[model samples]
Target: MDNRTNLDDYLAGLGISDAEESAPLPPAPDTTAAPLPDAANESPKAVLERFLRGLIARIDPELSVTVRETEEALEAEISGENAARLAGRDGRTLGAIEVIAYTVLAKQEGRGDLRVRVDVGGFRRRQADTLTKLAERLAIGVAKSGEPHELQPMPAAERRVIHIALKEHPDVMSESVGEGAARRLIIRPRHS
Candidate 1:
């Protein structure tokens, strides 16, 4: 026995009657459109603020981020009880978040040179102050002892703070040594 169903029979079986099948499709949507807004024209700080706020909202719905822009950099200050979690241990998580935020903002603005700094509960400021004091004390020790002192491994940014703190010391000098994660700053007596 042969079993063949015509097109109309198939449609009827599926409840799509001939009238509906014969109806013309809605007119094709208009394809022409104006160009997208120039992302470069938007402020980098604004882009960073939007990105950071969205990220923080995922972690703490009640938290808020405040962004400050300067000629040298953009700073995002996270405020809330849960904000400390973003800082992570030793501020590594905060550093990673800053890297990701700056990267995203740079790509969106078509400029990879944008600098963004992230801080949680004033952690970065306090850390910088601590590093500055340590550098001063170590420089004095090295100068008095006429010997070198090697500091514990630190991130590039922290090391930079130490170097800057001792940049003008008359009796001591600072240099970075070691490779990759093991890199650290060294303070030694000035030869002259």
Candidate 2:
């Protein structure tokens, strides 16, 4: 096919017409440096807590944010009437804030490569429990039917919950497939 034909085919696949295809792409994001916190003397956890508290206060003054550190990671939890708003639909907003918090903390002088997780109203814990139960039910079905089942796309942290939930299942095996946004978990019966 000629270049025009190939371009037309690609645009058609994306449900875009020739006129729509001519629209300019969005501008690139600004790369200017953000102001860093004065974290030189603060511990990693302290700095993370300070940032998270300020973030929650700006969003909702009634909400309270707290941070706790464990050997594995730092957990930041928000509790209040408006905390669910931070959870967003399917926890996207909560996840994004967690990512930004981790990035900022890791860049601080004393908190290199710190791991921080943000949760609103115990949403993460409840979501993990729900996912684990669903995984168990699906694994049983896949084992009985001897058919592989692909789960909905989930973030890496959520996918990890699925894997851990089924790791000890006697008749089912779990594997992650695809890449990036399309990545998901597949449950299949183990071969005897």
User: Cα RMSDs of all predictions?
Assistant: 15.9, 13.4
Top model number, lDDT: 2
Error of 1 at 5 (Å): 46
* 142 Cα displacement, candidate 1 (Å): 0.3
Measured on C-alpha atoms, candidate 2 has an lDDT of 0.75
- Please name the candidate that would achieve the greatest TM-score relative to the true structure: 2
The residue-by-residue lDDT of candidate 2 on 58-112, one tens digit each, is 5776787788999988888899987887899989899888886776576553345
Q: Candidate 1, which segments miss by more than 4 Å at Cα? A: 1-40
lDDT of 1 by residue, 1-192 (tens): 333235335333322223233332222234332222233455787667656754664566667789998897898899788777779998989988888787666656777877888999888989999999999999888988998999889889999999999999899989999999999998988884
Name the 10 consecutive residues with the lowest summed lDDT in model 2: 24-33
TM-score per prediction, in order, is 0.75, 0.75
Report the alpha-carbon TM-score of model 1 versus the true structure. Answer: 0.75
